[model samples]
Target: MSTIGSEGWTLVHQARQKHYDDRYYGHWLGTRDDGQWIIGRLYPGKSMDDGFRDGEWAYSKRFAGDPSTDNADAALTAYVEMAHNTFVWDRVFDQTVGEAIDLYWAGPEVPDAPKLAAGWAGAESPNPDRVVSSAGCSIAMPLHEAKFLLLHYLRRTELAAKAHLTKGVTVDRHGAVEKVRCATGPIRFEYGYNTYWLT
Candidate 1:
């Protein structure tokens, strides 16, 4: 483990030998000059089995084709930032939850009636007064009330995940909440009440 910056948190690093080859290769977590923590790798010699193997292990020319200034640091920074900002974090949270809600509420028949009914029941009481004042008349209901309710529930879940991811916090192997100290501060995860946080 190595400390990246002022946050006093240590980054995780690991090394392993490729199954077919005895050469040792490893990756380490570090921070960019722009204040982003990223995982960097040191590859061994060239091999056809590895995804990055082109031909030889000449250091000067190895990264020449890289788009991010042909710099390992830059590539790692880009990857970590992309994962944090676009793929693994809140944007993904919103997309996944939104899709789930839309799928569930797309059809006329409610997919999860028991769960939906439970939520609706919790929102209101039995014999509650309707909005309409006319005798024996009911208020016109929105066409997608159930869908809206589902969206609300999904949004709440996504928010929880976002909060956790951003706070530099994580759950431990034993199911305990632990503070994740990073150079950028505490990382919060958006894991919800019922979901697994560590994975």
Candidate 2:
């Protein structure tokens, strides 16, 4: 059973906040039978409130027209792909972290150890020394290399979590490129150590 209630209106409001106006509006209307329930004009750059009643009406009309058409399913799919692209992940780290790491170590090839180590001074440190050591092929590499390697591992963990939450997508370790894609496209990353040692 499908019903377009206040929740649907809430989603419409949310969509309007994201700048998706009328042209993108119809997709959100739930199915209705008589089509009378579908209200509102598809105006460009209109407020979500302006279209709320109409959108609800349209949904009701679609449902009235054919209850078995799976209108809710279609609407939900569109919402996930378009209206909620980032819903699967949260912003756990500051934007500067990504920027600093990219500026220092991002390139077509892996950077040299010393240069990579220099970038980790103020970044978030990876957990578990064993994971860090395993990632960098033994901790002999410069601090930066270990950090870079750790960042790569953390990114993989985040990607896996996102895929699991959104669309039940799972990327195998063998398919590294595919895994990266699931991380919402490529961006620069950095690795940092928990503490520095001085002689």
Candidate 3:
């Protein structure tokens, strides 16, 4: 089920802030439909010695839409994998920090099966669910900031996708965002079930 409740999202933010300077990676707690919490993180901008970095868009998609909550995470994860492999990650290396940031936030290639990647087909289009999500992301940041950023993004994306969401929908915090192809792979992230709220 979608994370319509607002509780537990802020803890995700706090964790990200805690690791802002000294650490390049961090984790947060999110929930499933049953109210089980999952471990998630923000987009780790740099590739740490521990291999902590992944594309920002990928992190957001996974953190918010993980399927294990109901075994329905495939559609979102598959699309994210394709988008990252298709339009996100870059091959250029040895660039300065600024240059790297530019690359991460750069516009993606027209995703394969563009209609498939889109959240919904637009009213003007032949298919109301076929329209690609025009909104993309900005420069990469730490996990703390990344999760919060995604909350705003989720607000935007949900609004853009449904044009009716006012504020309850959330991008979720922690959990293993399993790639659709990795049916047998181990869990990507693991954490305790803790929820944080604004109040």
> Which candidate gets the maximum lDDT versus the true structure?
2
Worst 10 residues of 3 by lDDT: 190-199
Please write out the lDDT profile of model 2 over residues 78-111, one tens digit for every residue: 4334333322212432232333332222223344
lDDT of 1 by residue, 134-155 (tens): 1111122232343343334333
TM-score of each: 0.23, 0.21, 0.21
**lDDT (C-alpha) at residue 18 in model 1:** 44
For all candidates in order, the CA lDDT equals: 0.31, 0.31, 0.29
Two-way TM-score contest, 1 vs 3, winner:
1
lDDT of the structure predicted as candidate 3: 0.29
All candidates: CA RMSD in angstroms? 18.5, 17.7, 18.0
- Residue-level lDDT for 148 in candidate 1: 40
Error of 1 at 151 (Å): 24
lDDT of 2: 0.31
Q: Residue 125 CA error for candidate 2 (Å)?
A: 18
Considering summed lDDT, which 10 consecutive residues are worst modelled in model 1?
Answer: 178-187
